[model samples]
Target: MVAYHSSALDGVAANPALPTPLLLRLIAFDGGGHGPPFQALHRPGLPEPAVAAVLTHPVLNARVQFAMSGQADAEQRARLANDSSPRVRAAVAYGPEWTHDHRTKVRPLPDAVCARLLEDPEPSVRSALLDSRHLAPSFLASLVRHPDPAARHAALRVWDELTPDGRTALLDDADPEVRRSAALCACPHDARLTAALLRDSAALPEALSHGLLRRADAERFLAEGVHLVELAGNPSLPADLVDRLAVHPDDSVRLAVSLRPELTEARRAAIDFTVAPHAQEHVGWVAAGIADQGVLRRAATSTHPLLRRAAARSPHLPPDLLRHLAADTDVVVRTNLAVHHPDTPEEVLMSVYARLGGTFSAWMATGHPHFPREGLAARFADHPDGIYRQLAVRDPAAGPDLIERLSHDPDVWTRQAATRDPRLPLPRLLEALALPELASSAGANPALPAGEMAVVMDEAGVPA
Candidate 1:
């Protein structure tokens, strides 16, 4: 008797071109290293063999079957489909010639083969089937019933093409992923299904529930007045859903109700009540659709600092409102007014500088594009804060005279700032440097000199 082992058969089965008859003979020989049990062997480079020889050799037959599957020959593929080994038969199942019609033509795969392969023993085979562009709906539906999450996931991925009954079967699927996928695919086609999914408090998992709520909210907010009114009239809407949507953090929702063409005055008031104060500005801006001073005034007076600041910077603020905010207590409001208020009077601007000190003064002293340079120069020169003096010295309006004046000011920061002033002439600058009391007072000290020091004058460019 031949004495080959299972391991030798595996080696031959793995080699596509290995002869099966020799492999079987080796298996019969208990894996002895000698040649085939049958001594008559075809050598290499032979022409096509008889069909009998090909069928008798398992390894050669598998190779022939694999080759026939690759060919356009349908008869050869059909003949190989009945091969005894599941491995060979499985190759035929995957072969290109095995169309949807061939599912029954091939030898019946074992239930375990279908079950084990439901997840696909091979990832390439599974993934190819999962992603098959041309898979028929009937074939896909059958695969969907396979007891594997992976196969179900694949079927759910293509669920859009399934019949209504097929899609309905997946609704109660054990896998939440499958249900969620179906929900997403179904939402666009069937409003009743979407509403049912959304309304089924327990049907949706938390993540999908939140996603659906947000999506529905967004869609409702964007819908026309007629549709929104229709949805609002639906008695089925949960009270919590209504309240949550009414007080929704989105400004657009409030604005939608506020500006709805069909809204009664009472409804408008209710929307105003539901919207947070901060969200009102968006409603007002959209309602006006143009710059309106009344809106600006209301926003400026709002208790919300953000609204107040926004109003202070609004292009829609009237000239009078700009004038009023020029002296606002909040430096940000005043600064925004200073920067944006085209009609801000020079006196109001000066008051803004005087009242809003530090960076605000510095901001004003650096000439605003619309403000007169002479007024800004005067403010910078006469600014009570010494920093503004430094600003003045740096100003183009500051000639040699102003530089001379600032260079000897008791405030060291002002003096130091003056020293770097581009407008300070070399003669006045040199004279200022010669004054020991002015230049020798630790010129680099960050602290400004106290107001009590002598004011050094150098009209003739004299060292003090």
Candidate 2:
């Protein structure tokens, strides 16, 4: 079988004039956005005929069209805007589901689709319409007044897009959440509104910070124990108020101070200093923050492996402790040192690997932070122990060539492991399945083509 496109939408280009059976297979393929195969497709270009086939695909599955809407020209987007499946229309309204911050274009939806999806029955789909550029000021004005307060909460996401009038409508909303969200966007609120919002327990910190409430009001709320943690987080607090909270009885509140110079000895010994139940990760952080050599050394030698693992990762862990931890009996502690302890000497890392020669940790320490080079990955790939070789095969640094070699590993179990690696793209997966011993496991691999998975059994002459 030909390899499926990484993104299901690209399958339309497989044959712009696909037969019904093939078209059905393409449409039935996973969305490839987040599920099995875990791949995303990118087309060199979309030919018009292929898109027409995607729209006309007899099956009602519209997810392919949904994925393609992002790349469609204005006219094609308009046609997709009217697609019968609400799912397709929702996609048109939503535009591209993913965009990085540096990307210049915040993909805008068509006005028609944007207006409709604002009231889309699907809550999540409706929330997405908040990002569409085509949702103009006029539409947002009406949306802000919609009876549903939920619409107001959703509107806050795109608050930067709203017109002055639209912004005003939300600022004056009866709903405290709308007002709270508006304040979150840094909109100034009047005293009357602030007073009302301050009384709302749910609206505590946001409303108080922007509310311009009197110091008396703030002190009253603080005395009442309203939003102590939140008050601690408010960056805009008056300096006098900040000094008062710095010594507040709550240790957690004291921890919240971003510029807190140091912890008092009594505070350091508090129960909050270390998390309980075998993950003293917090203790590691506190000790590192203080750069206390005594604390780190004690934690490193502690009988508890979790504390040792935590201490191993500390920047202040001295070279002597790093050496001590490299040879630790606990597998987690030893691996933690290999993967995370930068201060450990190269000689120490090498010795750790020699002790646990077959492990990923052993292979990993050769270059330290840099992935194992070809020579090291190959050494593990060619290791006598199938498990270590399997680990090497699974490592991202081990490229396709290593995978091809392991696919024919004499042990059926090793070949089976080779078949299911999520990184083993579909073409490599199919090639691995050619080894009949891999057949049973290949069918179970999430990477197998959903519609054509039967091919694994068919070619291997094994039953599903």
Candidate 3:
């Protein structure tokens, strides 16, 4: 038999003596001669039997009852605060909720209440007291050395509000993580402490970009290959260093340097043929290119090779101007006009292609989104380059013969691209699934029979 508190039935002389088991059953027993115990306990102005049952035998939790009961007022809260169970005391401490009118007038907890909890034997109760935003700064400063690291960590959040004397105490403390946390929020600008903090790997990234490390230290880390990828990605990385890394052997390193916020980064990522565009030159070019009545006037008169190239690459430059640029004395300017200007008219491109047929510029123009697909079928249908045939297979104009021809193209790329063709029938799709290399791509084609797809995946041990 389970024992229950007799306090549940106090102050009821009229209540009949009931068996302990029967009363225990009544606690959870909502159905009774007095209807449900729940309705009787909570509903006001109840009949005597229901009230008697509720007052005598309650199965409902005390916290829920306390939370719901209006009678748990200031006096009741104080009474519960002294209860032997720490749980009851903690619940009581959550209370005496301030009224809207008194919220601004009230502190988070009364000084006396805070004082009591500050000394609570239970860590949970004491930890709850740490949530007070309005706690005295001196109090938090003192807790910084609290025996419990959890409490100390909580106190660290208010480190900024602590007296400078208090902050000085923890800044050089033995714990590195605590020191790192301080460095992040403080931005103390102390070169020595910053260097020490950076020694901790956890703090290295922030330290590298804190913009306080000497240029030598930053460059030293860069040279030693320490955190190169992350260091390259740092926005605060010196421009000179970024320029140096643009040609690094590692593709990811160069890619990182290329993604910087401005045109410097763009130019870094570009094929910097022989001579590269300078930052100032790019700025001047953008200015003149966006200016009205000036690109023609400027390019005709300007002497800077990079500036001339930048002007040639502008989309707003007229077809007549693009044609003129195509014949420029500077080969680089002509190349930029041919390959980089997306808005250059098609007539200009065809003319450029005819003159510069074998150059990289012409090859790039051939695939430009605006390049007319007028003869893509004849030009690329059986082109030696697999990429070209892959493009041909995907072209909407590809006829059945070309699609079938590409389905067996020596290049797997062309074969994969053919799987998307609506004209490729179910038999060809089944053949595609039989090839392990093409099975995944072929499985995605709706034309493949569902049963065949299942069989192929099962044989291949593939999940649906």
Q: In what order do the candidates fall by TM-score, top score first?
A: 2, 3, 1
Per-candidate TM equals: 0.31, 0.51, 0.33
Candidate 1 global Cα RMSD: 30.7
Look at candidate 2 and tell me the lDDT of residue 425: 64
Which one is best on TM-score? Answer: 2
Query: In candidate 1, what residue range of length 10 has the lowest lDDT sum?
Result: 452-461
The residue-by-residue lDDT of candidate 2 on 376-416, one tens digit each, is 46567777877556556646677666666776787665676
RMSD for all candidates, in order, please.
30.7, 11.0, 23.5
Write the residue-wise lDDT of candidate 3 on 1-464 in tens digits. 11221111210111132223333333334222222222112322334343344433333344333322333333433444444556555644554333212212223334465557667888666665665344545556566776655556555777768777656656654576665676654544666666776677778776665435556776888779766755665545667887777777776566455444343323743723233432223333255345454554455334545556667766567666666666667766755665767665565565565556656666666655565656666777777877666657646677877777788889886787786565676677667655766655565564555455335323432222
Local error of candidate 1 at 3, Å? 88
Question: How well does model 2 score by local distance difference test?
Answer: 0.55
For candidate 1, the TM-score is 0.31
On the 0 to 100 scale, the lDDT of residue 223 in model 1 is 48
* Deviation from native of the Cα of residue 461 in model 2, angstroms: 16
